[model samples]
Target chain A: MPLWDALSNAMRMTRKRRIGPDQAERLLATGHDPAHPELDRLLAAATAPPRPHELAGLDAALAAFEEAGRTRRPAPARQRWRVLRPLAAAAATAAVLVGGVAVAAEIGYLPGTDRPAAHEQLGSRAAPPSTAESGHGTASAPAGTVEPTHSLPVTPGGTAIERLCRGWDDRRHKGRPMKPDDLRELAAAAGGEDRIAAFCAPRLRPPGNGQAPPNSPPSATHPSPTLADDGDDDDQGEDGDEQAAARNKKKKKEDE
Target chain B: MDDEELAGALADAVRGDSAAFASLWRAQQPALLRYLRVIVGESAEDVASETWLQTARALRGFTGTPTGFRVWLFTIARNRAIDERRKARRRPEEPRDLTERELPGSHPDVANEVIQRSETDWALSVIATLPKDQAEAVTLRVVAGLDVAQTAQVLGKRPGAVRIAAMRGLRRLAEHDEVRARRAESMPPIDLQSPRTEGV
Candidate 1:
């Protein structure tokens, strides 16, 4: 028997015989079942003053939440408002779009549709051939028209006029938004005098409103706003002069 | 509840399920409070509250067995005790708060009451005087009732370290008790309960 058995056993009954920390720890860890006097103490200790009680504050917190539920008052309405808030905004936005499109159609603003003359006034439809038929079939080409001297540097086999025409033409062909820089470069290279190119610009009359693009002069001649221009549209149609104003407005807005 | 059901509840609690959390509080609060009482001494209530707050904060997905749950709870209690000790050290020494925590195995019969009470109280008081390693070992083995391995798990100390602590703690208690008894015997009994008659 171990020398400490009597003391250990007595300690055990009084709850002090559990194995000391080291041995129990070793036994627990290594599976080496060492004797535990202290563990005995612990078990004995466990049996002390045996009564259970509720926590001090648990009842209070439960009551607060309960009362909040009973009142049907503060948080739910606030939460409901919060939850429905985004829903309400979405509904309003839908209403505006449906109502807005109807209002716009009433004013004959729907594209390419037959409308009353009063509402169609702002449309940029191609003009009738009579406007350009001022006798240009054989003689629209003046004595100066055949001269290539007015053209700027174009690639080999490509004339300046052809290059100039490609700038606006490519924009339309590509269906890309024409940056102001493109118009400026084209205008600068084409070197002034041909106001026709400026007039054919699509911005002459905005679809939604009759407002013209801002900061844009009546003609492309007033210092091209952009530094880079790709000459695409070769010839400005007869209504080009009228359309230039609207084109400039849209272009200016694009720049902004 | 079966282990699975209990594990599920604990897992849910860990996952922030308030109902599961309430269940845990209901199930473990009593034993936990008692453990807290002994561990933190006087301010067991404070320590217990702090323990709950911390447990609530750190709760995550744990599927613990009953033993594991007790270990977890006691680990929390142990940490709070350490914090309390640190806080107390920052102030002056005060009398221990006797919160009458009921230990499951600590009570003795009337015949043994005087001796056991004196021994246990003396053990508890002297426990703090032991080397820290020894004190922890002794507390786990003697007070907390953890086996050596479980105590080792709680403490992260080697089993050897724990054994040394208990041995040292026991020796210290024996020494302290001997000294007290000797002192008591040498001195004349000063009985305050009896009338303080004038010196004859």
Candidate 2:
């Protein structure tokens, strides 16, 4: 048995242990263990009442509480609106303005506007022959001359100029003499004068019947959009170009 | 204050009586500071301040006796201490003073200073030498005057675990060389005096 237990038993026999829970707590806090003087010193030292300076934080803590109480409701609500208001406005503007223009362009309502006219001006500067003969070829064909037809089945959005270039390239491939006029038109159909090589190199490949590709800008300058819808028309246009070139070839052979 | 008076003050505080709230703070803050000192060292004061500010904000929604209030306040203090420790680790700033670096665990050598400051500071330093969980268990048990059940609630540990930790911590303190030497010089631990100690 420990010495403290022997001593505690002696005390219990002599006097009643009437200490309440609070007294027991006080004894523990004060480090009053009979068997351990070192623990007593340590606990008493550790649990001593804090001095005045230690409680200095009370005022500051209370002030912080008061400040938080004052700002709790209004600050976060106002801040939320401050952040979200501009974002909402910007989203609305993008949805209404940019989306409207794109929608108008898709339905062809924009072609009659100054944007397409500006594009035509740039196209004319790229190749001057097209500008000179533009009204004659676009309006009506001269006697025995092939008329430039906008009704010719093409990838939608392909201009009459691009189709004419494609037709001319087809004919040249079938043993017909390549025309200087046709070369000039190809340059105009390309967006810039420097782009003629890049533009014609891909589109002039002989079409596989009804295999019109998606309108990828670099894979061919021609807008081969709407393959399923325009496949039959593309086949018909290819056949017509081939037949025209075959006739021209036969005529040249006979003349020789 | 008795339990009735404490419950009255708490009710008044919940109703926005700052004076009543201050009374509660005065009663509880000392023990809270001691507990935080063991866990957070020199930053205990700052953490205690944060804890009170949070307690003040949430007091209206708080529904319990003064004992419950202590548990809640200490819980907040422990969480704030954890956050401070995490922030300190991420920053790794140079210590502002050599004393703070040497504090909490290292026993001060100046005999006069140790005697004078033993009231709270020296005791905290000794307790801080214990393992983190043991230190927390001892401080929450002895300093905060929480029962085993309440200390377990604050530490999120089982009652038996808290009791074991506190017992181990006390045993370790008893076994310390400094404490054992002091025990040799001092009189026996039993006090035959009446149980009318101040602040009990």
Candidate 3:
């Protein structure tokens, strides 16, 4: 039994050591071994030429290939459009937001331009007392413009004088009677009610004579003469007035 | 196919040229079918067809050399074969007897073709008798003509393990009873230096 076990162990070791990676590579590559012709035959049989049944599915495979090509050809372009759609929408939204803020700032609708609200209120009061008392067209204009004045120091004296001049000119042109409240404010500003026309004569000249028309309504572009003279009252207000004046000058040049 | 021919065909195929794709199919289908025969048995043709369809769908996105393409192709076939086996296991139908399987022949020289086909079938049947890893390693290395590293990539095994499996598989084929009987018949009757004398 001991001798038989030794023989079997030796045989197993020899079998294990005989075939390795290098020998397998050689046998697979050349297949011309004189010592192992059976292995050569086995390899030859395994790698025989293609049988007829192997290529039978060519038509089906090609059809599938053509189908895949047809379906996938337009995918990249559609994918690109899909990826860019959101970016385009975001760009358009950003443009609208920026443009809206700029228009609001130009029209004195934004915060920190509290002087426009004060002027707007005085202009409402300076309308003909019958129109102002009735609470019609000019009364509603300053309602949206009144919220910002509470945060600012009151400076309605100059704006009131400009509004009275505009109201007096408008009444004279329309051949309408003057409102008593407006006449009282004009009397105070001109030192008397009879001198109201003289006080407004130089102030109401048509634009382009270094004096804008007082017949024109009080808007962001037309700062009251007293406000321009008393510039130290509000620095931001003066800057806004100057910018509006510069823009108007440029617009006038373009129009000419 | 050679590298240059394969590169050109792959480029044109990616551009949706049917003729170039057909060339690629012709070059790869034989080895793919033989490998599938070893792995999936009678369903080799079906699995190969599925593999080609999948390859066609993903061909545009595949970027690699010819060798890499071969590796990718075999990887797809292996995955499909695994799926087929899983499906077969779930169904659990009666296994087909190997002796009853028919060998197809379309050539005019009928007798010679039958003999050769039977030999090929016999060899493949013997290989199929090996353990799964050994059988796959041998089929990929010898029949599909892939290098050890490429076979490892397809089989998802280490190169050393694939090499060892292939070596053992070949050794087992060499030591099979039928192979030894055939070797004895082909040898001179009075030979004394036979290696079998020591082991047997």
Candidate 4:
């Protein structure tokens, strides 16, 4: 048994020594090893070109790619919404302010003080007489009579004009017809059928412009206009008229 | 694909282009599969599929050069292979000897048949016989074409350790009886004075 152990130990000592780490690193990096050609053959075999079955999963992989692409497509849109949300919130606030002013004008709360001054400004501009006449007629009437006659027409008349402007814009873009009653009310407010376009042009221009017709009292143009609209129009004037129009529409809905 | 083409494809793939991503898969899949084969044995294909799926899912957000992309892909594959191995250890299925695995059936195309029966299979089987650390170090460094630093990163080892493991693995393969036999069969008798011939 001791002789057998000695022979095994001798065999172990004669076995090949391990290659240097640097040499192994070089072999792996460059795939060349003159000292060990067998290792070269082994690496060459290990890195053989893919078999047909190896790529059998390509179709499934690609399907996963497409599904991922589909899921990722919405990320940009979400990012866009991240940017647009604040602007939408501000616009919504402006809409509420505009709606409040429209309602104030309808209730005669604003027209009592602001409408006379607006009429005076329009009177100097030599605006449509029907609008100036109505304002002068209401201001000249007794205060007791003013609330009953003045408030009634101003309420429905203000709403009718706003409705007509929205309907007109929609009709131009969508080919929808206006309600006949709204058209007649708008005609009466303008004092002539032909003057409706001339009357609506300034009103449709975004609120707080001070150019709205005298009959609507231009409450958005009032010196003490709703603070939010005043602030938003100042801040967002460069955002363009389309956004302002949308804000105005939103205000009208909120007021209603 | 060349680096220039790979860069272009990577950019396009990040923008959700399937064709560009396909080119990437075709280029990297072979190396990835072979590396996984050495790391995970019979579960290599399943692990590879999981790797590609994960790569596809993250492709849109991935930003890197071609080399970095390859590293990222291999890192993901290695992590998934580790997970598979952990699960395999828990379940402990029946062990089938490597030689007992089914051989490729006969094919009509001679070249295809030869390829199926090539030394690659034998070499891979031999590599799979290595100790786990040495096999992984060799496979990542040689089969996956990673540098020592990269192999160390994949194996969570220091670069020095990886180099040693790889060296030891190569030395073991060099002394393998089958490897020596094949070398003898391929070459004519040489001078006995050669250092490698001293033992014999």
Candidate 5:
């Protein structure tokens, strides 16, 4: 059942050992091989007890987990690579893009792109941008508009088609085409209005402060524009020059 | 190593010193391997590896002398041996080859004439039929070099149990030997390979 009673002494060595004079002679006989002592010695060694040297796997497993922690932090480039790669790039890009997407899917958006997306994000004050979007050209969400680099309160959208369909319109309470000045104000408020078209490819929402879109510089931090008083800007092209001047000043500072 | 030395080595190892760990392993492996051979029987090498794996995991906590190390190491080994036994116990038992058919000495070490002269073959055939626990106990005590207490610790039993088990095991072996001796007397002892004496 064990191996054979010949090994009984071997077993007994680890348990209770009692070898009579005659019994000892027999074990000697059974272990008649030249290496019996060596083999027995080794077995004796094994039976002595396990020490720290024997527990390699558990130590290795713990070390491996620690090493893994070092390699797991998400990088910003990895995030963009994930989304842009699959949607706009090749299969290799897709693989990289997918990784970031998986990561971003849970954490909200990619890091650098976070600010712009938040700026374009509507009434959801939960979005964190404007403060974060300064020099960034990209918005995390496809919907918001890019503001002039100098201004703030930029509206955002994914595409012109999508943009036109967003928000309740004044005429029919349904979505309608946005005015040119509205785009200008958004350009100024967001920062670098020239990039508005590229940004418009994604659907975007209007700035919360009732400005002329991303085209104007912010006169105030908070958008306290009551809808009745602020809608007047929707009817005019008068604020265009003022915003353009502000954008020119921003460009000059950038060039310096 | 002595307790202080072993503890110092363990301290070094826990501090991420590979050399300390290596020294510990080297110092402990020989004895550990010997015990494993008796416990795992034929799969000594494999069980030795498992034992090392276990030791590696717990090495950080070790702070004992070489003697204490042996006890600690054997404690783990004894548990493993029991586990192996449990596994084997679950399997269907193989029918034993108990028939008294002694083959002529065929090992290269034995001369053809001495092989013909000795009772080696008959002895081997009979011993091969012994039960596993008895065989293991006999092998470790006779061959592995563990004292009664250490052996008991390795087998995860009281020293008394180890003594009893060893006693019974060796007694049975004596019975087998007597049976073989009678058989040998009837057949005549040929001059085979000289019987090898087991180590003390």
Candidate 6:
């Protein structure tokens, strides 16, 4: 069979111990295969240098690679923001919880508002000396300082809802409805005080647009807050005279 | 590039300097393209482009000397060629006409015609006829000018395996009548129409 002949030929080829690559290369350079001199011709032919034309298209290829590299260099900053935005939002939510919610909201530090615009509105009146004015000092100041120009952290609605629910908890404990405020308005929009918790839960877990409830009218200070109109004089009702004076100062600025 | 120039360019390239990258590309692209041609045939240009693009993107992160860069570049190119082959297998294209066969001793003046056919083309054609592993071994060793260890690194094989493959491939090329016919001045001319003992 042809298989037997092939096996015999392979055996014969192997019988003359196979030429090492190094030895073959050496023979190739010399232009003579010591064992099979005839093969020297083939080795010499195969070893000929490639033509200059072989290097064609190289310049254009490198140009294309450089073009791609230029475009890809700026991508890391955008990628980093994609990872950090949510962590910032979560940190803001946790920070709002520790600070007194009613005082924070009364100073126009409520959530569901454009942060920079709210900071802009709050900027006109000097920030209150009270360290418990946590909403403006802790939440808005850092965001303003870090990314003062970029309109990135527009999701103050979660903070607004947290402030509202805290107010609802206070009203339930005191057995009295605190004078009409943003929390009261948000609760009313949710249909009742009982529904305030449910209403705030989804808003706290902000969706993509970061807007408050669609039906709630935009407030004077923050374009997104639906409860701006309800909390006008409630600062005095909740925090007595001094906080009310500060709220009056804020209201004057919003009106102007 | 000499080792000093290559090392400096490699260091600059790792720092994302485009000029350094271009210098490295100019020095290495010829061999890389030739090696790709041997393996991927017509699509070598596209595959080489993909390989360089990936290399450029990852240039900043690579940490090695110039010689290591060659191994890494070829490894990426070989992987890309393998992927192209697999894709081609899945969606088969119309077969090209292969009717024009080169008969042994067909040329009247063998030595002249051998010189006319550039060695790269002739050698690649012979290599294409070889088994895949042997062809890769020979192309990486001879065309790419990689040492045994570097060729083994590129091929993802043991150095011994790479050596054996290159040895077998060179032996086969030596035995091939077409290759031997090119060195007509040193040996008696072969008659393709008749069979005779392969006289050394």
Among these predicted structures, which one has the highest DockQ? 4
C-alpha displacement of A176 in model 2, angstroms?
74
Quick one: ranking by DockQ, best first?
4, 3, 2, 6, 1, 5
Give candidate 2 regions above 4 Å deviation. A1-30, A71-256, B93-116, B185-200
- Chain B of candidate 1 achieves a TM-score of 0.57
The digit string of per-residue lDDT tens for model 2 on B45-158 reads 787887787778777657897778767777777766765676666676745321343333343445544443553565677788898777887788777777778777777666
Report the Cα lDDT for candidate 4.
0.61
Better of 2 and 5 by lDDT: 2
Interface alpha-carbon RMSD, every candidate: 25.9, 28.6, 25.6, 19.3, 27.7, 24.0
Q: lDDT (0-100) at residue A190 of candidate 1?
A: 27
**Higher-scoring candidate on lDDT, 1 or 4:** 4
Error of 5 at A24 (Å): 6.2
TM-score, cand. 3: 0.56
Model 1: per-residue lDDT, tens digit, A121-145? 2221211122234447665546764
Per-residue error (Å), model 5, residue B55: 0.9
Error (Å) of candidate 2 at residue A100 is 43
Please give the RMSD to the true structure for each candidate, in Å.
29.9, 29.4, 30.7, 24.3, 27.5, 22.7
Which is the better candidate, 3 or 4, if ranked by DockQ?
Answer: 4
Estimate every model's Cα lDDT from 0 to 1. 0.45, 0.57, 0.65, 0.61, 0.42, 0.55
Model 5 reproduces what portion of true contacts?
Answer: 0.06
lDDT of 2 at A128: 30
Per-residue error at A49 for model 4, in Å? 1.9
Q: Please, what are the lDDT tens digits per residue for candidate 3 over residues A1-256?
A: 9999898667654533466566788765554344345676667777777667566789988998998787675455335434654564454356455565445423423343222333334433333333334556645546554422222322355454566777887897788978987776565454344445655554454322355544675663233333344332232221333343343334332110
Docking class of 5: incorrect
Ranked candidates (lDDT, high to low): 3, 4, 2, 6, 1, 5
Q: In model 1, what lDDT does residue A213 have?
A: 42
Stretches of candidate 4 above 4 Å error? A1-17, A81-256, B96-108, B187-200
| Candidate 6 local lDDT, A13-98, one digit each (tens) | 55355566667665423434555554544444344443344445656656755665665564563354346545644544554566
What clash pairs does model 4 have? A95-A251
Segments of candidate 1 deviating more than 4 angstroms: A1-43, A46-49, A52-256, B1-9, B15-23, B26-39, B60-69, B97-129, B142-145, B170-200
lDDT of 4 by residue, B1-200 (tens): 66777788989998888899998888778778777877787788888888888889888888887767777788778767766776787775857343344355454665664544355666777887888778877877777777777676656566777788888888888888877776667643222111010100
DockQ of 5: 0.03
